[model samples]
Target chain A: MLKYQQIASDIERYIEENALQQGDKLPVLEALMARFEVSKSTITKSLDLLEKKGVVYQVRGSGIFVRRHKRKGYISLLSNQGFKKDLEGFQITSKIIEFDVRKPTQEAADNLNISQEEDVYYVKRVRYINGQTLCLEESYYSKSIITFLNKEIVSESIFDYIREGLGLNVGFSDIYLQAGRLNEEEAGYLGLEKGFPKFYVETLFHLTNGQPFDFSKVTYNFEQSQFFIQANGPL
Target chain B: MLKYQQIASDIERYIEENALQQGDKLPVLEALMARFEVSKSTITKSLDLLEKKGVVYQVRGSGIFVRRHKRKGYISLLSNQGFKKDLEGFQITSKIIEFDVRKPTQEAADNLNISQEEDVYYVKRVRYINGQTLCLEESYYSKSIITFLNKEIVSESIFDYIREGLGLNVGFSDIYLQAGRLNEEEAGYLGLEKGFPKFYVETLFHLTNGQPFDFSKVTYNFEQSQFFIQANGPL
Candidate 1:
């Protein structure tokens, strides 16, 4: 990590440890500089980044205070990647519920642009962070493309297998997000009550050749997750 | 709309009107060209754009077919803009539920970067699309900055007022999205059953000068909404 990022992490840790509430003022700039053993400019840069991230705000003469709303477990929607890369300091694990090669459903066949006669590797799993179930994922992969997938690979990150093991670059994905009540089976897997609200995501992963290889439906526990996306203005 | 876009829209309308299903083959390329009275290249371009948008896919020998999943509403995560610009065909309206200037709560004070003693203009409204309630929003604005707001303005687009009325450019916003069940009051207003799952959003808006000014919480009805974000690969 860069020096500024390290300093920011230290400050974030301090805030978390102290359980700082909204509008609670932090230590003075000089104090932060002395405590972190950094120069004024370094402290200023770190604070600038933090402010941009909506962590704290400056009141000119009144000093810096914590913002009311703080983000937790932000999943960047922009990256054609998985949460394993972004989630730091959390132990993530997956339990494979069902993994088999089966005839593609009409929906799966249409999503992957394959015929109904073609077989697909269907995998369903529940993902946990720190032993708490966070998301339930049901995915279908074109067997013709991901021909080498097995139960072992299904137990881990499929994206890693595609990029590292298969040497196929994951290019982009089309994601649709909505809200829904968890069905009985999903509730049982996530340890939630029946009909609890959940965030639902449907994604189609395309390869570098612009051919979609995988389709997935993921349901995230409402209270334990947050999704983030950063957008720029049109040129 | 551009020629290609117009052709794409026409094709989309045809699909909707015909109630096209997954794997349903579209008209042949020559047929589409004849119907649209355009050259092969224009038709190809429109189809390419639609394919990228996950509307349709192609088989090497068969032809184009509709994809299983179609997105209805897409909220661009990257843009620091409003939904009005993106929702072109829909008739959107807002009903003011509560509008008042009151002493800022600690959370609102911190979110807006104002002192506890300062007053904040609070606005609550429900947004409708084609006569259906889609989202309920509660927002707080700093009275010292957005000083000209009224109930009439609150019933319309606040972003329009900030730009056209106050002449202040609405800059970037830090948004947090999560899932939650709607309470009784929100359920009643949105015509959803109590305990229905909904998508919740928390946004903190800043000015071009990097001053935080507005904070809002929007609850979107799960069944009637879908959010889309397109992310480019890292350079």
Candidate 2:
């Protein structure tokens, strides 16, 4: 990275470490220069980089201020880590409705790369944050890959269990993000009217070995979620 | 890539080239084996790879069939290619509502990395598919970088003009996908009711050199659009 780029990132981290809120003032130009031991032009270039990213902005007469609205409200690109990991720091909790090992449906068998005769773990849950319901989720796991599952595991982070306990590497997912409406039963659980708008996300997750292990459908309360994506390149 | 993975991708392309539909049958194992000059085991392995990806499925006693439903109803991962390129083959047209060189707002100046008094190419448009309105788009382009614009260029593709004509590399974007309710004016353009749910996409597009150039706001008609995302890895 260039000197300005490196300094720009350090100041970004400084804003985060200090937990700067929107409209909060950053340190003055002279202070940043003294701290970084850089020239005025370098400091200005660094601040310009941050300004371009909408991380912070300069006021002609007053001072520089934090501008975080553009940075927030995004679902980051690395969402394959699972929502729990993706939305870390939120008070997330899951209520398991059903968990069972049953015969795979033909569709599940194909997605999980297993035979219909084989068993697969089926799980259904309601996800909440701060005791407010947010989503309804259902998933099927390939028994050959996941090996085991219980209420204790389902109540918390299954992605963590898959990565840490099973010692497996998580890979890419093929996902479909659709706009949908809630049915009567779903509306009752979510405290919304029937036909409320929702985001329906279906994913087929693969292990690093390139075999799929899980298929999930999560319907999120649209009002409570803002999906974010960061994209790069024509390639 | 493994031989099977290679074959799996080829079969995926074959499905597209053949324009196969859901539940449509693929070539039999014997035919595939002969077509690729491979053994029956190799052909089956390739099919297994396809099955795991939900590209195709096999019946217990019957033949394999296309499973394009899981594949379609999606926008692809290469959406950075711009929506027109992303949704290729669709009949698309754009109606120019507003286009002019104007002063940037403070927020627009911050996003475009230009001074508030600087001239910017302001564009407002309505995009349609098969004459069905799908989105309302507005953008501000830095005049310093874009250099030129007109009705002809704006009517077709600014992304294509930026790359092929201006010889600049299009870089990544920071995007926030929010579910918003339409106001009266927007609803009129989209033929939806006031308070109709829509996908509000805000993007800051940069050139490969890392300078932000285009700041765009697009409100999509949700019922007519299904946003697709494919995610990969913890990284």
Candidate 3:
């Protein structure tokens, strides 16, 4: 390892051993340089590396302090998989707000390829991780295709029920994400102030037969989480 | 097409014909209902669909209004491609801030898999689309692999020079995104107030030989743009 990397690793170890929390300041730059037997430039480079990793941040005139590592929420845009398997090591729960057969709105009807006269199962849910509400999801499912759905299924992973219980094949999805200020009701459910920035994700899920089955709009608290996606290259 | 969809399409056409600018109020709900000979619910649903599609936004208690369609900038997370092709319709330009070889910081050295003693080509550019500064990019390249770079190359597309001029194969990238407040310098460059929300993206680009070549951090104006990704599913 390079000198600065070695120093950065040592500092990370120190942070761990001392159980430093967010906002806790590290040693002064001169003191760190002396302790590590490095020049001021070397110490600055190490600190810069730490800052880049989001482990520590600088306060300009004050000093370098630890940053709160916000727990990230990941959604694999590449796969039509259930969140149950992806969020391992986290306590995940869902609260079903509404589950009833409702007349499909024009948008939902068009996306689901159903007639406006048809009734779709509308399920609204709030997802939580470790007791903190993180996302509000409003989904419209075609009752004609997804024939087995209830409040119990809605509370759990609906994707699992569709694939395992109903023995159907789950296919791909087309998703669009936008950032916007949360409306009043969304802010209330997520415990955010009105007009707080939120990420709105619109997903259209299809089955193996190439029929759209579900259309969902998920709003996430932008401050608490992020979305991850990977792309392979031909360009 | 559904009845509401037809009405929505007609409304979109009307907006185009009138060349309504952003913040321009649409016709009153009652007027639209009477003109289309549709019920209030139908007109309301059509407007709701438009809002969801991001064509227009509603102001509660006032009326539905035309939303300025913000031109979206696309960065493919799955590919190590340049933005030149993606932003073809817009007038894109770059202002080179700094272009010279510099000793790699520890983070850059590790990401580019280079020795800290070796100098690397460092380039900083403020990218503008249609005369509006949208992103600030700071990129570091391995001198051994790239072997040739200058301000002229930085002003155009560096990826194009790497692939076309150097005859190198561009490969995949590992990207991480976080939300942060703009620092003083960044705010000055983007003309944003300090502490304004910004999207920070860190990218580590690797060649087809699995050797790291480029490390870049792009800070985007949060309120003016959004990042998009599409995923195909097998999982």
Candidate 4:
């Protein structure tokens, strides 16, 4: 890692371990330079990268503070081609079962916060981690974003394209979870018997501007996967 | 509604409208008594109810305070009838397609945080809501808890009986959501053509004392149902 990257991680660790709540200023540039034994320019570059990555923010005369919220949400681009970074132990296998551009259904329209007849892109893929079938994801994107997609892009993480290439940053999502039975086609694809129980989730992601960016439905096979959500209640 | 209930609603409305955050103390009893035009006894009674309901809490020598967290989690009763409370809104037509008490498999043992071969109650139910198939729920419960359960209790909202009568609460849960295709048995239960997509969620609830309580797999028919989760990420 670069010297500046090490500084960034050091600062991140300190923030995680201490009382550096949102809006708290960090040590001055001279302080960081002395502490890390790095050049003043190196410290400046590190803080700049952190700001660009949304890890921190700069206040012209006030100095820097940690971003109020860290990487709290994600816009996942589930695909067969290993995305930008793969989960260490998980191997992802994706099969594009369907891809089409069609007028949004009422449900899709409501999710995207658009008119019902507007065009949307529907893409479906099945993912396997390790050797076990894990999940199936069906993504719905507004037609305005369809221009950014192509068949070749489908093979990689669509999220990478949307972010690095298209400059669309996905923020938090409203998610729901429930249980239901699988239909026949899904059963065959997931290698399970018909009438088996499955897990389901629906998600709506919004951009930083609070506009709907993507909607998706996902299902997971029984016995092979688990979920973890941190509960931060009313407070 | 009772006069006290109205007073409670008024307080709740005031809190919301004024954007009062947790830890903010309520106005003094005399002030509330005058403002709401209710008897001192009535206002005190309303506050008492809110405290018991886990909506608010009081500290000795200190005034009342809003609860920082809503203690609204699950309670799994041993009885089948206790399942109705949380499982409401679904015109539930349930068939216990598979039910057993057996040694925990490796995966089950790991999820339940129990030793291999530990006894567990495995139950699978296919639920139909509104005359349409809705979801399938598969659950695993530790034998210690299920020993208190019976066929009659399994048919209802198990959460209610455990909470109301036994005082056992399923406190915090670490939930995860993903997407996947239905396997054959699940597909048949929901009456879907093969490869049809659905939503999937896997949940693990932990007891207040930090013991693993239950692991559940839920699947929902995409055309009919959606799961909802509200998140305010680590603030």
Candidate 5:
């Protein structure tokens, strides 16, 4: 592994061993560089990888802190397969679009097990990979479960909020995959021509005991996208 | 349901109940229309829907047939998702840029859990959604499981082949999602600017015994598309 990767792994180990919870502060870059006998550049790279994975964040001058957030889950988990990490070697960037609390739609209520008229926090985002517009993902969560949702939290990963802020153990989930075309609203957001063919992945997360929690759908431009599943052994 | 949908459902049921193997021909269209008391237009729509789903196909005036010699064990199912029905909606087309069988790479072998030297079929496609270069999907399959493959099958859904031809019991799968930037090879296929962003999905399949079977990675042009996942309660 690269020196930076080692630094990242070490930092992660420290976090785990020390039981340093999310949002906890880490040592200054200079201090870490001196202690670990590594250059500041290597440390920066190490931090970048972690931050991109929704692991930590910098506070401008105060120092880097472990991000108390859940990194987004992949659509592959919702299918009968796990994710293959080597597609086009693409890297993803997320932009927090809008976040707020609102009443659940019938569909959202049915999936999340919330009352149809109950208010829920909505987190909407436009995600890009390699600078191309890839998908717009909108997630709804019961306000009762996530009572402190804010723009700052939305700017990060909601998965983090469910796990860190609420101290809920993220568990296994159920998923559905389908293929479809872009709707007018989606096309507009993705900046594609209306009615473009796309792939749809719907995921529902629940506890091990089968309590329904959240639902999300991701539509990929099929004309420019592909799907993969990884499996082991014979049936 | 509409007459076309009814016919489509009936054919789907007939194939399921009678143990009709993959690549098996169905009753003629005239017989179908007569039995269902439907117009040719309705019958055509029914078949078209099935074809769009990769369930069936037509060969010029030679009449329609199920796609023969398809990849088995994995079903390629389709839905409009309330958008247009086919790739035409994207206004872009795809061609098999490359097709062959080769050994799975270290990563690929790790995903499929076979010997690294085992042969796997590889298919590469460049898709255009709405005249814009979208993505290139390069897929790999176990050669033994998928006895044959071709550009025609590549242009259609693989799920149809797996379930209809091979008689494998396909079921739900798991998926992993991420966002990343396009690399050199993907940039070449997408005609995208270097370093553009994209969304990536990696999925793995397993038999009921939790044995891994296949692995795939799909990348999408993030700028022009989005996807969704509609999940259900745990069974």
Candidate 6:
């Protein structure tokens, strides 16, 4: 992250920690500069970003004030963080419905940039937030990249396991978000009626080296799920 | 956009224009550098981005080869642009269902940061792509900001009108993406089953000066709408 963005995040944390209300005044620029050990220009840039994100606003000749009391968002569309990390302060758990190594399907092979002869870890999992099922995900991980996996690892964050356990850098993903309806099997798992409309996310994960590592399809619970995004700058 | 990103977009457009296929080789670094009037470093960064996006691959000794041929995406979630601008090639048309001036509702007032007494331009529109209905929308724009509106303007790009005719700089928006079921009235206009599931987008638009201007709710066809996003960098 850039220096200004880091400072902006720190300021957001400070606001949350202090329970700042809307229109609540923040410390002077000089104090913020001292606190963050940054220059005046950097502080100004950070404040500018905060203002742009609708978190805080600056009053001329006055001081920075909280435009919003809380940082309200569920998922940031630009962030690559998994649900465990993305939805912070939430108790997230997963159930491994099926886990096995198998031959890559044609679609999986094409998406992962691997041949059909290659083996892929075919995993079906259900993710729950606070013990309520939120999504059903089916993923195919290339055995070339992720060499080994077990039932235990599949129950937790596979991305974390890929990063920490295997030391492979999880780079970015191309995600396709579509509107979808639940089938009988999906409806049963998500406790929704058949033909209920919801969100579907298809993601292609890549390594930092630009090699495709995994592909996943996820269906989210309709009523309990909402995705939040923010965009700024001139039109 | 940054220099590297601009070059990346140009390269993508070139590939599209020329109909480059997968495994086709692009111009060499020196050739691209000369073509784009940039240096080797910039070309390398551009190519690296393309590689990460699964657009190309670099061979050790030969050249940069196409990893995938197409620039495939429907909508970028982070973009502040409207649907007309975002979907560049498609023919988009809007039918103005209802247009009038009204007192702001409490939710509308809160989202637009306007008072209940404030007058708002209430617009209802059904959008079609290539003559097929896609979405039904309802919007409330602050009269203080918009100043004026008409059925003709409502039938076209309202965002364009706000920018060009009104000479106002639109800043950005915070969007909420949710799963929704259509009501009888909405389904009637959308030509969908009354309880059919679909996608709902709630948007709060702000001006460059940190003032809220418009609040909108849009419902999209489940079968037709898809949103694409990408996130790069480590983990």
Query: Which prediction has the highest TM-score against the true structure?
Result: 6
TM-score of candidate 3 chain A against the true chain A: 0.67
Candidate 5 Cα misplacement greater than 4 A, ranges: A1-235, B1-92, B206-213
The per-residue C-alpha lDDT of model 6 at residue B222 equals: 72
Worst 10 residues of 2 chain B by lDDT: B69-78
- Answer with 3 or 4, whichever has the higher lDDT: 3
Scoring each candidate complex against the real one, what DockQ results?
Answer: 0.27, 0.25, 0.14, 0.14, 0.04, 0.48
Best by lDDT: 6
Recovery fraction of native interface contacts for candidate 2 = 0.54
Q: lDDT: which is higher, 1 or 2?
A: 1
The superposed Cα distance between candidate 4 and the true structure at residue A2, in angstroms, equals: 27
Best by DockQ: 6
* Residue pairs with clashing backbones, model 3: A231-B78
Task: Score chain A of model 5 by TM-score against the reference chain A.
Answer: 0.60
* TM-scores of all candidate predictions against the true structure: 0.69, 0.70, 0.65, 0.46, 0.40, 0.82
The better-scoring model by lDDT among 1 and 6 is: 6
Q: Please, what are the lDDT tens digits per residue for candidate 4 over residues A1-235?
A: 6788888878877877885755577888889889889998999988966654445666556677664322222222221123223254456667788888877778878777789777888888888776677778888898775455766677677876877778864544556565567789778878888767677667676553345667888777865654444331111
Model 1, residue B139: distance off in Å is 0.9
Worst 10 residues of 4 chain B by lDDT: B70-79
Among all windows of 10 consecutive residues in model 5 chain A, the one with the lowest summed lDDT is: A226-235
Question: B1-235 in candidate 1: lDDT tens per residue?
Answer: 6899889978988987999975688999999999999999999999976764556776656688875445555765445556775576888888888899988889889778779999889998999888999899989999898987888788777777887899885655677788988899989989998888889888888765546789888999887777875433321
lDDT tens per residue, model 6, B1-235: 6999999989988987998876678988889999999989999989977865656767667688664423343766655556765577887788888899999899999888778999999999898877777889999999999999998888877888998899987865677888878899888878888888888888888776657798999998776677776554441
With a 3 Å backbone cut-off (N, CA, C), the pairs that clash in candidate 6 are: none
Q: Candidate 6: where are CA atoms >4 Å away?
A: A1-9, A20-31, A39-73, A85-89, B1-12, B20-73, B85-89
TM-score of the candidate numbered 1? 0.69
What is candidate 3's lDDT per residue for A1-235, written digit by digit as tens?
A: 6899899989988997998875588999999999999999999989966764545766667788775332355644455555654576778888988899988999999778789998789999899877887789999999898886888888877888988899876654556665666799999999987777676778877664456689899888777666554433342
The candidates, ranked best first by lDDT, are: 6, 1, 2, 3, 4, 5
